[model samples]
Target: MLRAAMTGAIAAAIAVALAGCGAAPSNSGEGEGPVRVTTTIGQITDIVTNIGGERVEVAGIMPSGVDPHLYKATQGDIAKFEDADIVFYNGLHLEGKMTEVFEEMAEHKPTIAVGESIDPASLIEVANADGTQVYDPHIWFDVKLWMQAAETVQRELAKLDPDNAGTYEANAKAYLAELEALDAYARERIATIPEGQRVLVTAHDAFGYFGKAYDIEVRGLQGISTASEAGSKDVTDLRDFLVERKIKAVFVETSVSNRSITAVIEGAKKLGHDLKEGGTLYSDAMGEEGTPEGTYVGMVRHNVDTIVNALQ
Candidate 1:
């Protein structure tokens, strides 16, 4: 009896995984008819859904907390991409692994890389340890940049669905105000952490804009992409830095595994520095669908709250 129950549970788990492998249905309003759209990240999905409201149906190719850099779309995801009226992505090499697929989709659909619309000068470029500069593609970390991205989405949505232009504009404006408020809240909360402890170390290099906006020093074990493996030297350097600076905590990312971070902690301990576990931070993606961190605004707020509470 137990064996039969275990087999059934395993089969059910496989079914759920297979289901999630495909694209989710459009969240369009009743009787509105299908107007397909696909987003790269859940945050963008939320923005599109908010402005599009009942007039449009939106689906995200990448699930919450999935690393966009390493996401591999299945056969079902490709089907959704082919059928989308518009494809919205946070370009600037963010969709590292899926860029080729999006490019191919652009041949057939009105795919938009929203981040590309932002002024290049406003973004901060990252450098390798050897000092060659690379563009930081995680612009959504900064509320200001995210608001700009949202506006771009609003414009594109308006262009596609002229009848709902007014609705989109109003929704975008309200959402932008919320983003502004979140920026203010982050600033106030982050100020509580002492200047000396304002260092943020995470699993990957996704918080350049967050560090710049909030005056925190950011460090990541891995590069911009989780696809890249961290070297022993990279771990050693971070371990030494944490010990030398006496940083109290280092954070774990929600999307990435904690192996690298745990290694860093152990290395630090061996060097006579004990580091605490800073709370889990939302990096490559937001929280689950219903929680406070599920929405874009809530995601940023939750990050700020977690960082402040842990570091301060």
Candidate 2:
């Protein structure tokens, strides 16, 4: 029902947005100062901004603190796609309702799913609400995995604008170095927390990659997608896990409701376990534009610092 409603809205808006828009721009990268790139999700937008550098104009479809799992593309978003030289998004159903929009745009321009470009073996498999298996879409939590996404963006940008391939390469190399440093920082900081206290619980299972990369245990009240509501059983189970494990903190996501987390916390309290509300996490979304947490590196830094400080 949620997906259907979002899709209907998107289809209507897109039709109106493209009413008189002529053929899609050829995007040959000739006779242009910079290629216009449209992307969904702040993570991908940041990647394009860094890798494309001065050679691309980047715009994001989803704003900071917006849940991509439930984001319905607007007419303005359709206009952005129609005017772009390329579009990039995190696939594996990250932009659940926007999948068709991306597909339609792909026929007109280079539409790359940077997250899906990563190796299958590297992805975490989980059962969907219906019990079918799918790879988790929140790949940015793992800095190393996101580095791969950066590389994918660099490669595609080079393909799209060979004239600026050198520029993209140089920019990507620099950005990658920063990400490497960020990854090391996450590893070092996460190591400071005792193994027993390294557990991270969030509103949703958006940190599985982060847990695997940093050797911490991760739990979420809801499933991979926020569309999958947390049932009373889920809250009870998580509550018990926290109490039994003596977990100290539960984190809320900027894009997800804190109601479930609150329920889990109250349940744990009733069982005589005091749980702290760890600072907000930028799961499934980034921070406000221009803020430190708005960028991918800053967002990861914020999350790692928050988790370590809380659980330490």
Candidate 3:
């Protein structure tokens, strides 16, 4: 079993990591130019960059292929956060490891949790180890929910840089429209997969929101947080499920290890179900900077295209 990872030591550990990194720049001084924005993940970074355009200097703490669930902040990241005019993060524990740092910074900065801005009623509940409920934080998988996040970014950007409020609003309007079109594309492509084969199996439960939005059944060997372990029973059960349902493919995430999914495939193969590896999905991280999967919209399109092609 994985250790209960979210102890008080998390913040203290991060503080220690940032201690040696000398003084960081401040946003308080007069004659500030472009808005210095720091985002916790690439997806959030993409949105802020699109909405802020040439007016904001955006830095993403977690780079491509880094798993946010277990990401630890370095001294340079601390400096970036400290110097940022505004900070945006996906809340509801998606950045579980960085929650403490974000909470502390929220006290004095324009730090915003874009995920928290979504209507709680629309958020999907996941059970924790203590049987308590927590919302799934992978809202970006659902294009519509991501649109909400973009709106929140727009609101925060306007608040932080009122001088460019109109520009931010206009950019947000255009991006939101693009997101609407992306949502339609996802739905259409997903519908192409035969209804019975629409089930999505990933390494973890990150795709719950995506499944809900796209009308597919999603299963994972591990729970919502990757910090949790997939026990033998869980693996066996998933293996049996795949074999029984004749699931054609199972996916690996770009940021997450594929060991669990591989186990499922081996288990199913032993039972005479030959499953294939579906192309990797950008779950916690987007693709490299220059690729289509690097941007949020491009990532979504890539995912839908991969899934439809694999399962069709």
Q: Of the candidates shown, which would achieve the greatest TM-score relative to the real structure?
A: 2
* Comparison by TM-score, 1 against 3, better one: 3
lDDT for each candidate structure: 0.80, 0.86, 0.85
**Candidate 2 colliding pairs:** none
Clashing pairs in 3: none
Write down the worst ten-residue block by lDDT for model 1.
1-10
Winner on lDDT (1 vs 2): 2
* Local accuracy of candidate 2 as per-residue lDDT tens digits, 24-133: 55454685568888899999999999998888889898998899988888777887877887889999998888777776666556789998899999999998888888
lDDT of 1 by residue, 68-89 (tens): 7766566567556655778899
The residue-level lDDT of candidate 3 at 46 comes to 95
Candidate 3 lDDT: 0.85
Each model's total of backbone clashes: 0, 0, 0
For candidate 2, the clash count comes to 0
**TM-score of the candidate numbered 3?**
0.92
**Model 1 spans > 4 angstroms off:** 1-34, 128-132
| lDDT (tens digit, per residue) of candidate 3 on 218-270 | 99888887888788898899999888888899999998889888888888888
lDDT of 3 at 253: 92
TM-score of the candidate numbered 1?
Answer: 0.87
